[model samples]
Target: MPQQVRGVIARSKGAPVEIATVNIPDPGPGEVVVDIAACGVCHTDLTYRDGGINDEFPFLLGHEASGIVESVGEGVTSVAVGDFVVLNWRAVCGQCRACKRGRPQYCFDTHNAAQKMTLEDGTELTPALGIGAFADKTLVHAGQCTKVDPSADPAVVGLLGCGVMAGLGAAVNTGNVSRGDTVAVIGCGGVGDAAIMGARLAGAVKIIAIDRDDKKLEWAKDLGATHTINGGQVDAVEAVQELTGGFGADVVIDAVGRPETWKQAFYARDLAGTVVLVGVPTPDMTLEMPLIDFFSRGGSLKSSWYGDCLPERDFPMLVDLYQQGRLPLEKFVTERIKIDEVEAAFHRMHAGEVLRSVVVL
Candidate 1:
């Protein structure tokens, strides 16, 4: 029998998301049904609601989710019912060319459940990032469920499902911050703060955080920034270089994807230093940096997709670290809300009042 659960849905573009009763089908082959414990209200969810991602109308909005495995469909073996898991958007398809080259982090073919969840009246619903989870339960591809330490608080651990992982991976995986390295992160949003934490964890000697908001800069300090540069008050690149012994940071991460911020990161990196772009940019955006500057910058210009994460190999280890207090995951959860509060949470986000407003089921 199908089950009806309360979920938030964006009925159409630019429309406010509303709580509704959604029908969840039985898991299909290689799929799983998750009893979601908590789901974070991320920017992507708001983007989906605004139709910024696509015209996938009536989108089921919630992706940064953690839950307990309620059941698995045929051929599912990586996890079992009752397993505690963090849901990931990218369910790596092993046969993709990237996987064949052993770079599964860039796996071209990711997956989602074949069957669709629906509104109570039978309208097909598109799950946000293929893992709509701002509900009591959700359906996803079996591979999307990454098992983690059950001892860790699910509310905090679930955040790693998206923004946190993307930011941390932006620094450690794509930016490749190392011991004694100088790092700079542009934007003090959740992702930027995570990059600062990653730099700290990697033993960076100086971590400069640049943002326009003073509250966010304070949040960045708590996360591990050695220094803060208010972009609104000064030239971000100049301040960053001044903090790093008059030389720019070895790795500069642009957490704000606008072309202007990208230029800031590009110029604020030392010669041969890497620039990691984890920020999502709009299609209207374009860059006009000189060809000579591109040639002069001798290091990698990389984009981190889902933080170059391999869920099976990473989520569990991070959860264990969180359980041991090595990672301050709890600090990221600014408030716990119900599924119905997603719209209000978006308001809070727009006002820049909180780090994360998570929906606790």
Candidate 2:
């Protein structure tokens, strides 16, 4: 039987999201129903609400989430009922060229629940990142559910589903910050701080955090930053260069995703050092830099997609690290609120007042 549950939805562009009754059909083949335990109010959700993602009206928002499996459909064997899991947007298809080539992280084909969740009048809702979890229950492909230690707090571990994972992966996987490396991360929000933590975990000797906000810089310090730079006060590139013996850091990560910040990141790394872009940029944004700089610098410039992570392999391992008192995943959760307070949380996030406002279901 179909189930009716309350969910947050963006009805139109620039309109505030509202709680509405959503219909979830029973799982089809390779699908599963999950009882959402907690969901993070990510910036991507706000982007969906503003129609920045697409003109898909009535978007079912919320993707970074943790839940328990309630039921599984035919051929679903990855998880079973009662399993605690973190939801992920990427559900790699093993047959994709990327997967076949041993890089499933870049799988060209991913899976989502084939069934469409709808409004009372049967208007189909596009789930944010194909995992609408800001509700009592959400339907996702079985592969989207990555089982982890059940003892882990959902409010904390669930963050691995999105921004946190992205930041960590940006440093460890994309930036390849090895031991003794000097790393500089710009933008000390949730993602940026996670990158700082990742750099520290990867044995970076000096982690420099750059941001406009002092509070965020403090947060970065707690996450493992050895030095901080206020971009608004001083030239970020020069500051990073000065901190690393006038040569710049070995790896520079731009988490701000703006042309100016990216340009700063470009020049803030030593010659032949890496620059990793984990921040997302708007379509209208463009960069005008001298072509010769790229040729002369001669180093890797990569953009991290979902931190180039493999959820099944990364999530569980990261959870274990958190449980062992290594990763400060809990620090990322600044506050917890009811699902009804999502709209207000968006405002708090915009003001840079919170790292992450999780909705505890």
User: Considering every candidate listed, which one attains the maximal lDDT?
Assistant: 2
Please report, in order, the local distance difference test score of every candidate based on alpha carbons.
0.92, 0.95
TM-score of 1: 0.99
Tens digit of lDDT per residue, candidate 1, span 1-361? Answer: 6899998999999898898999999998999999999999999999998889999799999999999999899999989999999999889899989999999999898999999999989999999999999989999999999998887888899999999999998998888899999999999998999999889988998899999999999999999998999999999999988887677889999999999999999999998899999999999998886899989779889999988888888788878878888888788999999878889999999888989999999
lDDT of 2: 0.95
| Model 2 misplacement above 4 A | none
- TM-score of each prediction: 0.99, 0.99
Cα miss at 91, model 1 (Å)? Answer: 0.9
Q: Compute the lDDT of residue 298 as modeled in candidate 1.
A: 90
What is the per-residue lDDT of model 2 for residues 129-189, given as tens digits with 9 covering 90 to 100? 9999999999999999999999999999999999999999999999999999999999999
- Candidate 2, residue 297: CA error in Å? 1.0
Worst-scoring 10-residue span by lDDT in model 2:
49-58
